[model samples]
Target: MKYDFDYLIVGSGFGGSVSALRLAEKGYSVGVMEMGCRWETDTLPKTSWNIRRWMWKPWVGLRGFFNIRLFRHVMVLHGNAVGGGSITYANTLLVPKDSVWRDGSWSGLEDWESVMPGHFNTAKRMLGVTENRIMGPADILLKEAAEECGRGDSFYRTQVGVFFGDEGEVQGKRYPDPYFDGQGPERNSCIGCGGCMVGCRYNAKNSLDKNYLYLAERRGAQVFEETRVINIKPLNGGEGEQGYEVTTQSSRLFGGLLRKRRWRVRGVVVSASSLGTQELLFKLRDKGSLPNISDQLGRRVRTNAESLIGVRLPGDPEMDKGIAIGSGFYLDEHTHIEATRYPRGSDAIGFLLTALARGQPGYRRIFTWLRTLLKLLLTKPLLAAPLLLPFNMARQTLIFLCMQTLEGHIDLRYQRRWYWPFSKTLQSFGPKIPTFIPQANEFAFNMARRIGGLAGSVITEVLFDIPVTAHCMGGAAMGKTAEDGVIDSRGRVFGYQNLYVCDGAMLGANLGVNPSLTITALSEHTMSHIPPKQAA
Candidate 1:
């Protein structure tokens, strides 16, 4: 069968970008479809408060880069852009603990400890990993808090993807072709603007579009931005044997009026993050486009077991003078917390955090919320008053991104609920994951006590038993067979050929750190399995 392209990649983030570059370099025609818009450095939002350019809800006419998708059990924060999550991510790239490789469906499938190092090294080189140059007040406070918790030895600077310039004279200066020797774009050193999460406008952050997607385009790969894939059907009644018939529609505000377009491809790589891959596959399977998808499609969904905690200081102290995520400390073997921040005047995220509460789901959580609010009102009335007032959150707050390597996850299923009586949507299923982690709260309380500030957490975790996670992983996990998982250890769907999943959806274990680097390394490993395109 003649194909329009050798490979069709969905989502232009870490996984899709890597696939497009490697496949196109191997002489295959590659096309990447991204539902988000292309973002240039100068065009990025000045701050998260710029909702029209910082938040995404196209139908409501807010076409931004960040998406906050709320499920019953979890609220997922992710990026939507040509560079994927890299556009809005904090740029910290740390490898997970060795124990992470031993857990989950993919465990024992390969000798991961021995083989992953090489791929990780290649990914690091391409991403331009560097040691953080500026350590702001937030990093110092984290160290002090670690000492208060008797874990001071565990505090360390994070390895980030930001350029910090050559080791000598000046910092935050522009440099020419540092990583790829003129093949990649020129970069400026990080000015410690704390704007990485708001979209790095200084050209300091090593986003994928500056590296992988840029190289892929130079190799003749095509990227279709603002095009969302709607349907994927196996052609000639067989998956991959006769290629695929792919259909997509515009994702703009006027998408409903736009006619859908169709294409054909010899293979499809679904790298649309974890949530996206699960939703798309669920729709296709239910619609009978690909009927052989495994029953384990939406199982083992991990969220890094995360919590966002913070402490608000009354005085301005320049907390936003460092990188978005500058440093971290491990509370214990399983719990890790990083000092996170936004640029000055970027206070939109502050609205999502509230006073910390501890309890299980249901009525007990509501009781805990009331008790915590009462404690704040009685003991720290001065701090409680500011919660109702307008303040410079970035200049006076220290944000903590807390995560756990503990293997706790919630499952997702597609259903038509009563609230939304229209189309089927993804819903959280099964037991509720823990909304409050004791170690994280203890650390936050200790930090607030030390600094005489107010400690807080996400309000959704208290009121609705939902934790916010930036790293949503593992819905189409890798297993030995179809009965056990959706895809094989090699990332190919079971009972199907030439159909692959190489994104966060394939992650069986949650990395305690950011999952971007792991996703890139895993994509590199998956793409290496396929041979170069055969000469006609």
Candidate 2:
């Protein structure tokens, strides 16, 4: 049968980019449909204060990379761009503990311990992962806090995907393609600007566009930017045995007419993030576009059991002077904490922060917050005033991103909201995830007290009992059968031929650390199962 390409991949993220490159190398034509704009160093925003160029809220006319999605149980921070979350993520890449292979739906499905190390090594090498070379005030503060808490032994520099050049050489010096032997784009050494999240204007960050997606395009893969897939249906029909027809439309809200386009491909790879893949599959199943999709589509969605807590120092100490997350330490066997920061002048996120109030969830937390605020105002007005204000926030604040390996999950469903009855959308369902981590809060409080600063937390955590996480994963996990999960161990969607999901959605376990490396490794494993075009 004739088709537009050998395979059509949705979402040009860590998983999608890897699949594109490997498949193309195997002599397959590939098409990547990404619902985000392509970004370059010159076009990157100077600071997150440039809302239109830094945030991704298309409905409100703001279209950039970073995105925030609020759910009933958690606030999810993700990204939307050609390179996906890698453009905004901290670039901290660490391999999860081997115990993860024994947990979740994917347990016992494969010999993960024996197989994953090679893939992880390959992913690390491709991403240019190395020990962080620069450490600033924020890292020192983290180390001090860890020592104060008697956990200094766990403090260590993060392994990141940045080019630092020679240790003694000048920073920000341009160099020819270092990783790919001049086959890739030229890169500059990191200048320790702490602007990774705002987007790396220095070209030092190892974003997918500089690696996997770059190699894929060079291998004849076509990337269609700002193209959103709306529907997918198997052609000539019995569970995609023949080919598939994919329908897409412009992702811009007001770009032009709502014209739709179609593409036919022999296979399809849904590599959208966890939330995105679940939402799209739910809509397709409910609308009868691909009704054979497993009923376990949105089950077991994990958020890495994460929380956002921090400290706010009054005066400028140049806390935001290094990479976004340059160092971290383990508070205990299960919990991990990383010192996070933004570039100076990118203080918009401070509006969502307030004095950390430790108490029970719900009304009690609010009451405690009020009392804490009043006591600070009355006892130390000078310190309270500056800590509460949003000015100089990036320069004066230190964020603690805490995540746990402990298991917790929520289910996502496509349903109509009580307020909006006109149409149905993706909604979170299940027990509320923990909004407060007592140990993390206590550490923040002690750190603030010792440093003469103020403990802080996301305002939503205190007011609405909702925690925030940037590492949302799972939902569409791997399992042994169609009744148990949506996909198999190799990422092939159950009950469908030539269809796969190779993204965070396919991650069956909750990786305590960042999930980017795992996703890349798993995608590599998935691609290994496919034979080359000649063999086919």
Best by lDDT: 2
Model 2: residues with Cα > 4 Å off, grouped in runs: none
Q: Write the per-residue lDDT of candidate 1 for residues 121-140, one digit (tens) a residue.
A: 99999998877888999999
Candidate lDDT (C-alpha), each:
0.89, 0.92
For candidate 1, the per-residue lDDT at 403 reads: 89
Using Cα atoms with residue i matched to residue i, what is each candidate's TM-score against the true structure? 0.97, 0.98
lDDT of 1: 0.89
Choose the strongest candidate by TM-score: 2
After TM-score superposition, the amount by which residue 40's alpha carbon in candidate 2 deviates from its true location, in angstroms, is 0.6
